[model samples]
Target: MLTSILLRLVGWLGGGVFDTLIGRVADHLRQKASDDLVRFQTGVQADTQIALAQLNAQIEARKLQAQIMEADRGWWVTSFIRPLIVYPCVLHFSAIVLDSTFMFGWGIAKLPPPYDGYEQAIILSFFIARPFEKVARVFAAGRT
Candidate 1:
């Protein structure tokens, strides 16, 4: 159950940068429409989208902050914990079935296509971001 939750959380959290980008894009388009009003475009549609997204992002971001932090904490903490939980059970069960067979006695099947990169990007992003954030966070935190 925890594994399932972690997998889902990783996928969901990984999409956050896209969410923020979309919110910013909405802001940009709204600005452009207002600036390009020679066509008499009210920019109302874009403005409405931007307004709604700002509110939505703020509320949703606050509600999900904890899961986001946990997901971002560390690569090994989440990534390795998953396989550590899965591999043992998989091996124990497979061992019983494959012990006498000619088939390889201890292996999981290979992932297909995009699913292969799922763990790599989701987990690695935390690792990559952690150090960058530590350095940059000083600016955000302010100093004496």
Candidate 2:
């Protein structure tokens, strides 16, 4: 009689209402454990796959970070470094410097100085590293 009364009281309080909820939770836990066990049994391949996926994601994130850093580095290197390195080395290597604006008259007709073969490189890099360019534009427009 006592056992029957206690069971009825427990059922009335929550046992009946929570039975399906408890079962669902247990099912989810079981599925997760089974998946983890399968993954573990796959040995190094599973770990390697996970690590490779993470590294690929990191590569993309690092690329974006690199762009941010490049933008911050600004235009000094682009303007000065490329010309200093390229004009002497690539354009007129071992040749005598006949003029400052044009070296040995071996330059383009209207391309001007430092605009040989790498003008696109100079222009693109110049605009890409443009944190100072922002300041210059603001000052030029007299907005600041």
For lDDT, the strongest prediction is 1
For each of the candidates, the C-alpha root-mean-square deviation to the true structure, in angstroms, is: 30.4, 17.1
| Total backbone collisions, model 2 | 0
Which candidate comes out best when scored by TM-score? 1
User: What is the per-residue lDDT of model 2 for residues 29-106, given as tens digits with 9 covering 90 to 100?
Assistant: 999999998878897788889999999978876665566556655687675665565454434423323444455565
Deviation from native of the Cα of residue 124 in model 2, angstroms: 32
Model 1 residue 8 CA deviation in Å: 99
Question: Which residue pairs show collisions in model 2?
Answer: none
lDDT of 1 by residue, 25-141 (tens): 999999888788844555777788899999997786555655455655567667676466555545554564575465765554544668546644544554576568755644443
Please give the lDDT score at residue 63 for candidate 2. 69
lDDT of each: 0.63, 0.62
